[model samples]
Target: MNPRKSDWQNLDLLLKSFAQISSNFIYDLDDKKVAELDVKLIESHLSEAGHDFADVLEHLCDNIIPQLSASRGPRYWGFVTGGATPVATFADWLVSTFDQNLSKDGDSIASEIERQTIRWLCQLFNLPDSFDGLITTGATASNFLGAICARQFAGRRQGINVAQAGMANLSVEVFSATPHASMLKTLGMAGLGYKNLIKVDCLTGSESMDVADLAYRLQVSTAQTKIIIASVGTVTATDFDDLMTINQLAERYDAWVHVDGAFGIFERILEGENLSNGLEDVHSITLDSHKWLNVPYESGVFLTRHLDVLFDSCDVPAPYLAAEGDKPEFMSLGLENSRRFRALPVWMTLLTYGKQGIASWVKRNIDCAKLLADNIAQSPNYELVNDCKLNVVLFRPTCSGLDQQAADEKTTQAMKAINQDGRIFVSPGYWQGKKVIRAAISNWETQIVDIEIGIACLEDIASKL
Candidate 1:
């Protein structure tokens, strides 16, 4: 009996069983452990002669599924992770079933769907029709795309094509006050050494860039070509750089402005927020659908008005691949020649929820963060590290009667204790040279009740410390 043919014969039954298993896990996510695993037990399952597909499925249900981290759960406050909505999950499954390589048009409707999704995203963000974009594999790739465009634009200004000439003798200066780590990695990948990043001074007691300092640096800088990476929402504090002033400075200095709005762009959906007022003036922007859009993993987008520069930077002249014409040939716009139909989930989620639903989700998550911050402020055991900005709360456990060093150590201990408690999950980091616990309220499922639970877990752990 050939296992492959046998599995094919029973595909329907196998798929049904798989769906049931997935449904059970998602339905029981609230009660499941946040994270659990035994490395030795997992290693024991590996064998040279694999079991039948049915046995493998049973093993996954019995062993692997139980040990996975429940990052999709409502109480997961780490890493700014977003949980997939039901419709989005369903759309993702459809994407897999269709399995279209969304590199070019004329093959399938996937390319058209992606184009429409991009246009819809632009409208949702109030961006002008002048902007064009392509979906990518999360913020890393999106930022990389932005960097590639910036490199091409800068090189063109110097009468050289960096993509064709390579980065042998050219130097491009990048300025940023609080660039995300991924942006730095993008610079490195784009042949502009990360070490060359000119660190502009941030505003006092804030992660936002200081416009005056940036102007001063730009005035003094001698680099022929420059790029400015502006942050819409910083990771640790959720603070936004002054994009309006930054764009003015970029214009004065003839610098290409790239806004890394990965998770921060959603904040614009909330009424009365002007943090992203000058977003349209920027040359390019990066947004992560997985972080705040409540979609599945590995989805992001890079938008730019300079489509010509993006094409010149990333396009590969191959006769087999179609050239850009009336429609976008996605392969020429960014990385990945054979790309997944990631836009389907985004498109479906947007269609189901519309703008109002997304706005409500963002506002609720911000409210949860604010609730946690208020609780931390009232508690004597924990100190609020920063004012709750957007949807991230930064705080630390107060260790009375201890020196600074000892207090920092205690903060780390408290963070560990809270994570180990498993009722909720939070991450540890340093804020202004002191240890802090960062609770990033990003999941659409997260609510005020989950924040209350987090506060309780924090209090319980702080009491022990």
Candidate 2:
């Protein structure tokens, strides 16, 4: 064994480490501090410190979390992160203590717990009871698997043997110019090259693709086009695309409609039934629990309408695995054969707070985002960029005669100034070729005062500029 953690003492130490990490209310959460502590460093030291994970983690706790948490402590606005709920954090510790392996049907009790949790997620989103779900690393990998499932469905329809012989009569286009980076990366994973993406005059001519525009594009294109990836939350301002409209387009063209709802799935669960008009139309969706649900990091979920499609995507037959006439297995459905019970913390959070509490948590940050938008809209020298669709607000300075590049530079300076001041942190992004500050309000613990003070902090920085 590399470093056998024998009993509860090690687990207690682990819990204490996390608790100490959480006690620091003011942390930056720097991306660089994390980048420095990657696998190469671990692999380099694995031989040197064979039975010393405790020592390894001790070093990281002393140097890493302290410096890294600083990045996200100042109103901490980047990549739609949510401060971990206390119940969820505790549950995560308990889960690690248990050390569950959530892979197979007969492997362990952890499998059943995760299976139940998957069912809970399906019900939470009002998806079909028969749907298959898996907890993944994050939405990126989850999205890729969903796309792969779609690829399998498309190939099976053509009798092409794509998993073995590979895709041929398909261009595998996104059909929308405005796609998340996941689309490009998913294209690579699905054996559909990025060059195959057919930009359909989106992110430029229209905010979202209309049915007429989609039909027109598909008319010009051949049957080689197989998949059409759609976005639930666009990266810019968390604005949700019209899925009902996209659903119609995908159906008429017989293209697989995979909805990349990484950060946006909570909008359906937490926003209630009225906000989700036609959510059931998409073939599949991917969710990120860490973003809005606030259950520590790396608890992403993938769900599909056709359970068979999901289960069939990773069909593996091993003689030692199961008997010739055993029950239908769940592990065969996902990307991995050996996975952690990552669902526990999420399930624990849901079990503790229930749906209403999660709704309140999501709404609190959303209201906070709206609060900042109203403040930004009222500011004299600032210009509001886009509608506060979900928990993201986009704004920029109203300094006239400045080129887009210069405006972007000014926005960057404004963001850094606020961060360095150690009061607030906001990220810079582009919207319609204009430079803007993007504030993502997904943190469950972020207060109303944080929003007010953050806006004031922005005003202070802008005044200096």
Highest TM-score among the candidates is held by which one? 1
Task: Compose the digit string of candidate 1's lDDT tens values, residues 72-188.
Answer: 878888878888888888898888888999888876788989999999999889999899999999998999998989999998998888889986766678999988899999999
Global CA lDDT of candidate 1, please?
Answer: 0.87
Query: How badly does each model clash, as a count of residue pairs?
Result: 0, 14
Question: Would you estimate the TM-scores of all the predictions?
Answer: 0.96, 0.86
On residues 45-96, what C-alpha lDDT tens digit does candidate 2 reach at each position?
A: 3365375777767777665554453323327787677778778877887886
Worst lDDT window (10 residues) for model 2? 30-39
Candidate 2 residues lying further than 4 Å off, grouped into runs, are 1-62, 70-74, 168-173, 203-206, 270-276, 322-330
Please name the candidate that would achieve the greatest lDDT relative to the true structure. Answer: 1
